[model samples]
Target chain A: MPMPQVPFDDRGLAYGDGVFETVLLRAGVPVLWDYHYARLLLGCQRLNIPLPSREQLVATWQSPPNAELEILKLILTRGSGGRGYATPDNSQPRLLSRRTPFVVNADRWHEGVNIRICQLRLGHQPLLAGIKHLNRLENVLARQEWNDPAIAEGLLGDADGWLVEATSMNVFWQQAGALFTPPLSQCGVAGTLRAALLDHGVVQEAAIALTAIHQVDRLWVANSVQGVWPVNKLLSETGVVLQSWNPAGHDRLQVVGHELLGYSPTSR
Target chain B: MPMPQVPFDDRGLAYGDGVFETVLLRAGVPVLWDYHYARLLLGCQRLNIPLPSREQLVATWQSPPNAELEILKLILTRGSGGRGYATPDNSQPRLLSRRTPFVVNADRWHEGVNIRICQLRLGHQPLLAGIKHLNRLENVLARQEWNDPAIAEGLLGDADGWLVEATSMNVFWQQAGALFTPPLSQCGVAGTLRAALLDHGVVQEAAIALTAIHQVDRLWVANSVQGVWPVNKLLSETGVVLQSWNPAGHDRLQVVGHELLGYSPTSR
Candidate 1:
């Protein structure tokens, strides 16, 4: 909030050496604050980046509460100077938070959006599997696989043909009447909303193979900032529809998103 | 030299969505500039980030030429503004250059260093392999495996036990009088010096198994900054020497490094 202590040579910029959290704020209150805060803390701890007190993070916002939703980003870096990869014995962690306007299409909540499978497969690294660290070039590359405005998201899998998650959100699929999400032990960011859902027993972890993608009947993508969106279709690179799902069967799942994000079908 | 156009929310800072080059500058001239430039261009091209003109990059140095050697780091990032992973249509590239005094242990050039195998193994991602992108948490975690000043570098291998490289340098080993280094088509940074060596036909690529670590009588680690360091001994986690190499047989290999870096055994 104050002039960031992160210098030009900060490791975060140099080597992607940090963790970040994106919180959706509504009327100065963070939606799913407990889940987001817990993940932020876990990420910092996993990376050995000493975290500042909760008061320090909370104090970053000085603007008056806006009635509308806004995006708040928190970045905690290991700070500068360790001669390449070595952590400085006396390293001082840097904490930075920025608030920006939030924008979303309310229709997507009910109308759903089409998604695709990405060509780029995520490599396995259990040490960094679940933490939302800054090394997200894989996600960036997967997201860049398509620029078509109609295609809202892309599904990513590991090298072993196991589904991981969507480009910017955790993915859940329904075949019978239960919900299943990919396990993040091998790779992928452990989204806060996904964690909250698992904790509440709303979903179960399962390994979905690439060959079985079309077998599932219903699918949805979600994140803390975007809430939830039912995936209406899955398209191939050549624009052929590979799979489709009906929103009628998945409308009940949307209720969980509304309760978690404090959103309704009419709210943006 | 001008003020950085990168904002607090730049993609590079947010996701490490960029490439970097660390050049050893000797008397204002960049050592191995061509190889470094080529990799930089390849990285930007691979990520679809437009690169500026070569002359513009060269112009970032405003200080008078110094006779002493220094480290020059150039970072080029996909400039801000993209909906999560969707790149902005007219995204501008940001280039930043910083110079810091270079320091090295000259004795390591001749006396060599002791090394160890890292506990962490690199994940296979051919798409991002060997490009020197900023998603380098693997290297950071590998380097953190040890704090012993005696262990100059950590050797890294893939999940299948095939040797990849070291934390900060490309690795080379001599087997039966022929030089062999790991192929980085799956992962690891394809360093400028390593490319130069391969270009000059000074070395050949081979799949060195982790079990063959002790079988190779000679090993060396190299990069542009420190030139090269021979492995005098290989230590296990318990501080026991797993293998030892005689510098007398590998002094010829060090010559290749000295020639490429424009350094003499006597020079710093």
Candidate 2:
């Protein structure tokens, strides 16, 4: 059967004039409610969309029970509108939530994953940075860079050659016992996991250089769904193989990743 | 009454993963069907969305009775999926067509428009550049740079401080009897008007510099809907006015804008 679909208008389809978030749900409970709410509000403020209240969001998520483990997504758009880029005369934000069974290869999260540098570079637009706004053609293009299921993720670089983040996750590398991730003041989405790690002092933020990335003792990737898994190998642009790593940051990453929604790290 | 709203899972709302076109319909025929169809196909190819044949697009438009001027919008999203950025597996694209009363203030296009430099810098993702893909948070932020009604449009700049285009349209400036526009290979949507102007030998593409704009003899903005309008005032970041513009491009813009649009420029 066809899943029920939404009929969005030009604003949502013409311009990525909205914001969204995917929450990890287990036993019908959405994890990181507060953090996600905060991010959603910030995104609304940034995009000038009148935020549908947090209570409204919560009510929608908890309205009904569904599959035990599912991915809950909240999309907030500027509602339907006419042509042109101007905000509507009267703006009412559209809030929607749906639950679907969340599935992923558990083995990949446990065994270190492999990633390649994508050819597509993210443009630097600070005004639209950090928040998980819907203008993600960059991510879409980056994700489509390869079709090999073996390649777990693709790392993106900004126009100036600065390493930004992975296609769908924030990146962290440990060097000399210090956790460092790229600062997203310019580009890249600040993932929920990266935010938690930053708060817990498990990961640090900095501008990561492409050349310096290989020197890190260990490399790991994190997102709301995929907690954190060390990068076993990185395929450079020239097809040179970088040695695998099991960063010490995994202990903190796994602890939080598991605690968020019971994604315990075990040998797959 | 609240307009129809799409659920968050709408592919248009989710990944900016869709295609769309807005055309002026008058006397029961679309003004620029060929241009809109060509651009829509190009957009579909760029984003990997399957394009409906021109016959399909026109069949829907022709079904409606001929009427006064209307703004016709055709939005196509990958439709709804559970979650994640991947284009939904085997998803049928949602096609939405609506006729809205054409409501642009004629004076803005007739007299001239005030253009202000926006603080929101557009990101340069090449793969998505030139195509009118959804993922328009940058434009939203740019439009939000000002709420002043007098400021007609915001001139958007890229991260490296190069002038990309306006918030919603392509820009053209005449200097020394030659017209120039920002190249869209790195950023900005390649407006249908821009293509027409280039093909008809009306304007040439170039990397517009912040310092060089002041030297131009005249300036104007063009989009499929707006056709072309002069830029009377150019407000810089420091609130300095560039100068006045001669509205000589209107005739040429309208000729190209109306060609094969099935409407005479003088009729409107």
Candidate 3:
């Protein structure tokens, strides 16, 4: 299929003036549709962009190519506006969706993935924190920190050295059988899967420091697209192993992922 | 003219992964073309997007639009990419430009305009600071703080309460016959006009606090679109007058504007 073309005046392109969702499609069905949609609405409200009807989104997701496993990206922009930053009273919201083939490797999922810490520190802005807004240059720079395919992701922290999240996933650590994740009120995105884990009472949000990652018994990173992946090794920028863990807790997370995201380890 | 359409996969919409410039066109010619193009190139370099050739940009800006006074917005995005924050190896850059009619009121230029302080504070991101990139949600939110036409602009400060810039213009204050503007190294855009003023040795960049704004003898806001507007009164969020200045320095700034921006109050 051909890619969609966006207007030059799109406020999204002009000012990163929009929000987005990346949903995993399994067997032609979108997973965690409710959570994604709810987050989208919240983002719209935060930016004061008019919300599109729910039916419009559902219809777009329902009528799609029958791909077995794909990544469905939905971008909601404040349409087009004038040259300045002021929101026009007559401005309308726009929805753009596209699908791309994707496959999660079973080996990486089973034997956890390696991660490295990023040098780029995210600045604190509560007004823009926790929402999947389009102003993501920080994430882009963090993700570009490593070129080695062995490093699955890069961990990011706030300017004050508080552990936030991975480049695109939420970070969670298990210490004494209690799952703890960082509070994203100051920085970092609030992932849909992270919220689901919290709602299911499997994870607790707390203020975590970068140094605390070494004391954790187990670590995992998660997103809606890949569900969850255990962290086998965490490395610093100098390539020194900060921490390493066994995959003993992988099975428990697999069960939790199945219950929360309707994901199956064997599906891949 | 109608608005331009953008593609769904455009990186500018995806992650504000682009650079932009707003140039003022007088009698169908782009004002301060050299400075705007230089800044655009610098922004593209900072974001790692391939720079568009100068010939391509000049040709676009030089095209006759037949407008008396207009605002020409030029956006250059990293074309399309896969669904991720990482830049694609084979990504192509896209250029989009549109012209819209705009005119500065004579009263605003001659009698000075009222200004207000915004509640939304700008975050410090030295990596993305000073460059007029596509991530402008902060400015968008700040501009929406007040709809009162009497308030010509909103003054924004960094998270540390240091004055940065207005919602769209660079801020300058004259104290004891010396022009002082906020340093944009930590936050705020380094506007083209601001650079021009500095190059002329008429303005000095300093770390000025929000409270220091009241002590200044005179104030002015500047951008390429609108040459310069003197601030007659500065108001707090509760409509209380924070600082009021006479028009003593307005004529001096007008001469500076005429020399630097080729702007004449009588031309409009």
Regions more than 4 Å wrong, model 2: A1-7, A63-68, A103-105, A237-240, A246-252, A265-268, B1-8, B103-110, B246-268
Q: What is the C-alpha interface RMSD of model 2?
A: 2.8
The digit string of per-residue lDDT tens for model 3 on A1-268 reads: 6777677877888899999999888877888887898888888888999888978887666765567788888888898887778888888888888887778666766778999999899998888898899999889878877889899998998988999999999998888888888999887889888888888888898877887778888888888788678899999989999989886544555568656766664332
lDDT of 3 by residue, B1-268 (tens): 5566677877888999888999888888888888898888888878888888878887765767766887888899888888888878888998888877787666777777899999999987898898999889999989989998888999999899999999999998888888888889877899998888888888888888897778888899878777778889999989999988776534565577655666664332
Error of 2 at A146 (Å): 1.7
Off by over 4 Å in 3: A249-251, A265-268, B1-3, B248-250, B265-268
lDDT of each: 0.84, 0.74, 0.83
lDDT of 1 by residue, A86-131 (tens): 8778878778787777876768887889999898899999989989
Looking at model 1 chain B, which ten-residue stretch has the lowest summed lDDT? B1-10
Tens digits of lDDT, candidate 2, B118-177? 877777677778877777777776776777898888887776778789988888887777
* Per-candidate chain B TM: 0.94, 0.88, 0.95
Best by DockQ: 3
Error of 2 at B84 (Å): 2.0
Clashes of 3: 10
